[model samples]
Target: MRRGMLSIVLGLALAATACGGSGGAQQGGALQGQRITVAAVWTGAEQDNFKKVLQAFEEKTGAKAEFLATGDNVSTFIGTKIQGGQAPDVVMVPQVGVLQQFARNGWLVPLSADVAKEVDANYAKVWKDLGTVDGKFYGLYFKVANKSTIWYNTQAFQNAGVQPPKTWDEFVKVSQQLADAGTAPMSIGAADGWVLTDWFENVYLSQAGPQKYDQLAKHEIKWTDPSVTKALQTLAELWSKPNFMPGGPQTALQVEFPDSVSQVFSDEPKAAMVYEGDFVAGNIATTGKKVGQDANFFPFPAAPGGSQAPLVSAGDAAVVLKAGKNQQAAQEFVKFLATPDAAKVWATAGGFLSPNKKLDASAYPDDVTRQIAKQLIDAGDAVRFDMSDQAPAAFGGTKGAGEWKILQDFLGNLSDVQGAVQTTAQRLEQEATKAYGS
Candidate 1:
């Protein structure tokens, strides 16, 4: 989270000359190009793929695009840079929390009206609308990775004589059956804290529909709602089941959830199922398992006889800065991003789901990916952005990690579920007040 001196220098230089007017100059000196520096939170292979796409952009536009790609503590670093006035022309934050902060602070500007129209015309309006604050669109949502999914081992389910659970009772029955057969039923870890947040979100989806989740995001619904409390209590009950989660509370207190997910992918008497986002595809591939064939998914089911709901999902967005030196150039860059070509580039990258409706899923590398992509697009308006991300900054706050820890503690203890929900809800409300004038 510490600010680097290099960032400080860049911040000073940009502020000195560019603050008074749009700093839209083509690259100075030998750079001799429309130089735009973009920041993203992607790293390693994901980072490499981004570079390739930016290179494609550079080649097509004859503009010089540079990337400030980092993997560690991106939110803090981006916050520091914005505060220091050294913000990039465009920043691709992984979380909506950071984007909302930038919008609130006036660091980001609404997408050009023309850009907004194009986005709405070409894709769903909600994607563009979700990034907005105070009636201005601050970001262009390029891709989304939906998280509310249940991953299962195909062969193990067959061996256990089970079908993908179609209801909540069925889900629990399948898990207990796996446990009775001497196989670890579910792969879960909460050592890093945020892993527990997944359970909160999933149960929240089950108890309260997507619209309620959106209300929770807006702080319109009180945190002490009975539904919210029930969601937390239900997760505690599941976590308390015998041999339910691998290594139980002890291992969860020590391991990251992704590692736990890898266990389900390869380790045997194999784990039967895991609930996670699309990111688990990579972790599974890293374990030498293919997703569609070796592993597959089903949506978390509705309450018995309750209305079926769209899967809970989340996405990342790219945005131009209102205070940036190069507004028009950045706007054009965003246009390029929304095009079919760029959508193809991102789909091929393996970690993203492009929002462009025109990009054919058949073009994806495998059937599993194609099926999932089709499902996401066909999900229509049912897809809700991540609640934590959509929430007012004060409630959603940095406490997501801490809240996850609190959830784990509440689950392990079992007796304190109601108290834990009440306390966390109060704290979140207080933080929201701090973020926005109540």
Candidate 2:
């Protein structure tokens, strides 16, 4: 979604002319002793790749950058930090709703004009729009994902004699075939509510079409709309059958997101498929299966009204906090993120996609990730951001509440509950109305 930047060698050259002190000679006077702590939901390999960016930053600016793993509930964790006057100097926010909410609350500082200029040069207008609140820039996208994908096990597909399907009916038929052949058809990580939201979004976008999808995302149309009803019914067709999931719905509810991905590629796995963003590749890497041969992905199938699903995408954005003592260093750090060099660090490491138009396609380590990035960039005006991410935190970002909880409830009790689809849609609308005040 954005720009490329200067080499670290340039920073070292420029530092000598800007400062007189021996220590400040190698480090610019402005950022000599600053330490910026960044908070995000990334951990393990995700955090490791990010640390590479931090390593590059320290080499350039002489400021120490440390990462704080805020776990899966980043919005709530950061909110609590801001409330206590202990906010991280920078944050890699995953939700647009959370970014806009923080901006509106005046918790984030406006990025400098230089950062905006870089954004204008490298990113698409849609990316700038997502990071901007009320025409002011408070954040910029760093990494992006194409969420419209379903990864499967090649061995399982071969055993079940099923190819990737193109439509909802065909997908269901394939699922049944896989089940009948004694292959676990799907591995859902319903324990994490966000995964369920991705499922709903892919189906709703494909079936309802873009116009209605946009209306519902902004709450201009209620969740109880006919489009929403149809999407829920479509999802119900799969959720109603316990046989479709590994160890049935109850066991599926206990599995976390990473385990769900690993299972798809595991030897004698509990299940053979997982759905989410392209980031699933990161988890797949640890499972010892090569992508494209042992594990592969296909675009989410088209629903009834659409020939194909539009690309539903999401990205994490970097922002500076006004409350941090190292806010100036934090701004410079965000500025570095705009550069191609920073993106290249993660791109070559796999499981990373940058929105920067200038980032070379050759930077990616593998063809699968490169092609995924190409799909995202080429989607152009056809891209729609995650719908739940566009809604308010109370309605979309909260755990055990809001759309996340409502959808998870619907999935868990699909068959036993009467009128569950309608009930779930009405509940979603109730939360949206309360959160959006519409």
Candidate 3:
């Protein structure tokens, strides 16, 4: 087994280097000495893993690649750069809506024919559709997040005599069991509305299915739809349980995402589990807990009456900006990133998952990550992009005014589910009218 694993690893490394070498040979002297800037909303370890990918690109193509960490406000920063005529050659946009907006405004360069062909061959149809806008390809989805995971402390579950739940009923029973043992069953970072949005997406996707999820995201269905109510009521089952959440819903609304992870894995754990993306594994490690041993995750179970288990997923797409200084080099770098070989670099680095269908599951460093990659692949068409991220920024992405604030309110007051859903419907209608003048 060890020999076979080593052979697979070596094969991937050779393939990556060969892909990079061929890319350099094709670009030849045109991109050899050019400098290109790439901007992304990554810092710390995430940025570190990305830099390794960039370094490989530079080494292979002989082009200097500069990474600009855009922090959390990439849209603002990218807009400022574009206005100043200094947009990065490649900008990694986290939201498809924003990428489409930029493409529609003519700020993005359509992918070269070669790059488009590579994307078509390497990515799934959904990913291809996401990168293409107005019938033209503009972005390459490189990294993906599996949001249908619930990270848990293994010891905590063992101590509570509860196994990981496989269905929503089981999930509830497990939560109550954990709570009865004097431990908080879950930790929620409702303070970050995005986290709340994720919670709702998983429930909505699983309960209402993808067709309605698509409608809700595109505003074809009102937020007050019966499906919305049903999802919320399902979520409220756990939320309403006494002592099920750490410090209850009010305290959850004050806990940030990192703190929520800490609460689950800390030396004195306040909670047993946290529902979040695969990235939470890294956060668990940071708290001095070993991910596969001390902390691990199970797939979020199917809600009762739901069609199938749903996987709410999100990814960053690399789009070339028309205003960039080195278009040729930028295009080459994006093409490099689209390859399975380039994806393996960061996939093996941990805390990273690629949407490239061609990437090998064996490329991931551990069984936990491998499971995540397999879950994402197995989800296939069942996976839906985070609905809030796909919605208009005014309604879904705004910090304190729209979906975020309203959902935070609901978290603090579970008894007002109908009121909250109705208000969300009205807000979406108003925001959609303003955005589309409809």
Residue-wise lDDT of candidate 3 within 225-285, one digit each (tens)? 8888788777776687799888889899889999999999999999999999998987898
Candidate 1 per-residue lDDT over residues 349-428, each given as its tens digit: 67777767777776577777776777677766667777766554334434443345455566556556556667766655
Could you tell which candidate, 1 or 2, scores higher by lDDT? 2
Relative to the unseen true structure, what is the C-alpha lDDT of residue 395 in candidate 2, on a scale of 0 to 100? Answer: 82
Which candidate has the top score in TM-score? 3
Per-prediction TM-score: 0.84, 0.83, 0.90
- Model 2: lDDT to the true structure: 0.80
Segments in model 3 whose C-alpha atoms lie over 4 Å from true places: 1-30, 416-438
List model 2 lDDT by residue over 1-438, tens digit each: 100111233355555443321112234444555688988788777789999988877776677899888877776788888789787889998888778888888888898876777777777777887788888898889988999888999888888888987677888889899888887789999888888888989888888777787788889988888888888887887777657998887777788888898778887777778888888887788899988788888778887777566689998999988777676677778877887777898888777888887789999988778878887787665677899888887888777889888988888777654488889988998899999998
Pairs clashing within candidate 1: 23-325, 394-432
In candidate 3, residue 364 scores what lDDT?
Answer: 93
Q: Top lDDT: which candidate number?
A: 3
Quote the positional error of residue 432 for candidate 2 in Å.
Answer: 2.5
List, in order, the clash count of every candidate structure: 2, 7, 0
TM-score of 1: 0.84
